[model samples]
Target: MPYATAPDTTRIAYQVRGQGTPLVLLSGQANDHHWWDTVRDDFHPARRTVTLDYRGTGMSDKPDRPYSTEGFAEDVIAVLDDLGIGRADVYGTSMGGRVAQWVAVRHPHRVRRLVLGCTSPGGPHGVERDPAVSTALSDADPAAARRTLLDLMYTPAWQARQPGLLGRSTVLGDPAMPAHARRRHRLASARHDAWEALGHVTAPTLVLHGTDDRFNPTANAPLLAGRIPGARLHLIPDARHAYFEEFRTVASPLVLDFLGAP
Candidate 1:
């Protein structure tokens, strides 16, 4: 229920849990602060985790205008400033990863380390999602949207074996995203081009992806690690776009180690 006021006068809802060095968690496009619930617990014990609703999502103010990664990045800084956190580690997934790039590049002194999961630099060099996957993401029906996304998020075997886990992802079902907001986020994601600016990031970085990511192509992982000096790339086998969720047991430890958690 906590909120931070952005410089533009928009209210951003955020949550702080556990206690340690700040670790901000940024969710993917169209998802709210709740989307990080799947992996939230893993970081909470060893880190003071912060999660927020992007401008057009969750409890945050939903402006009907266009959105940009840079704007999203500012929202993050606003939340951190409100919390009195001068610097923090960041973990960004999918579209959130693009925004994190801006945060590290534009606000270099504010990031201690960075983690980009299932995301890309997002430019001419990035690989686009499959046409079928893109169509599913644009579906209006909430149930249909969940089904399509779950299929792309996890592999067939994993889904079959983890039926209960699927229900966890459906917690935020009512009043699904409107068409306009969805398109705005999509456009914002598409217009992100940080390939040229990535080298400016001085924070130690970790790039993660699943071998079978259906949304952002897996190849984007290497491109990110290669471009950022000293960045390491880790690929999860038999996982998809939601690799962090599907392989949290493995992913969590890797992230904690990178963050120097005990």
Candidate 2:
């Protein structure tokens, strides 16, 4: 229930769990802190995990304008400032990775290390979601939107095991999300192209992707790894876009090793 006031004065909601070096987690588009519910406990007990709900999602105050990736990165900084966390490791997934990349470029001193998961460099070569799936997400029915998201997010095996994952869709379907906010998010996402900005990021980086990701192709991972100096890439086999959920056993250990390494 903690809230941080952004420069625009929007109250962004965030939650902090566990205890150790601070690690801020930025969730993907249409997702909130709840996306980390399953893996929150997987990090080292000594490592603090901070999960945030972007302006229009979860318990955060929704605003009418300024929903760019740059805006979201500012929101993350405001949360860190509120908590007196001067510098921390950052982990971002999908859209969150875009924000993380911006943070690394714009506020390099504030991030010690960076982890980009299921994300792209966001240029002409950046992978795009299938039009059908994208259309389904903007549907009026919450159920339809959730189904579309799940279909785009997970592999068949993950969906079969967690048939009820879409039940959590109500968080995104909240009435607080105005039509304009949704439209702005879509516009920002579509227009986002960070390839030009990648060379500006100086943080030690890690890129994680799934071999079978349908939403964003795994090939994008190697492209990113090749672009960022000293960056390492890891691809999970049989995993889809949502590898964190589908292959937690493989994913968690890899993350822990990378994050906890001396």
Question: Alpha-carbon error at 37 in model 1, in Å?
Answer: 0.8
lDDT score, candidate 2: 0.81
Highest TM-score scorer: 1
What stretches of model 2 exceed 4 Å from their correct place? 135-145, 169-176
Q: Each model's C-alpha lDDT?
A: 0.88, 0.81
lDDT of 1 by residue, 1-262 (tens): 9899998899999999999999999888888888787679898778999989888887888889989999999999999999999999999998889999999999999999999999999889888888988888669886787788788888788788876755677323214667687779889999999999999999999999999998789999999999998898999987798888878899999999999932
> How well does each candidate superpose onto the true structure, as a TM-score?
0.93, 0.91
lDDT of 2 at 113: 88
What clash count goes with each model? 0, 1
The top-ranked prediction according to lDDT is 1
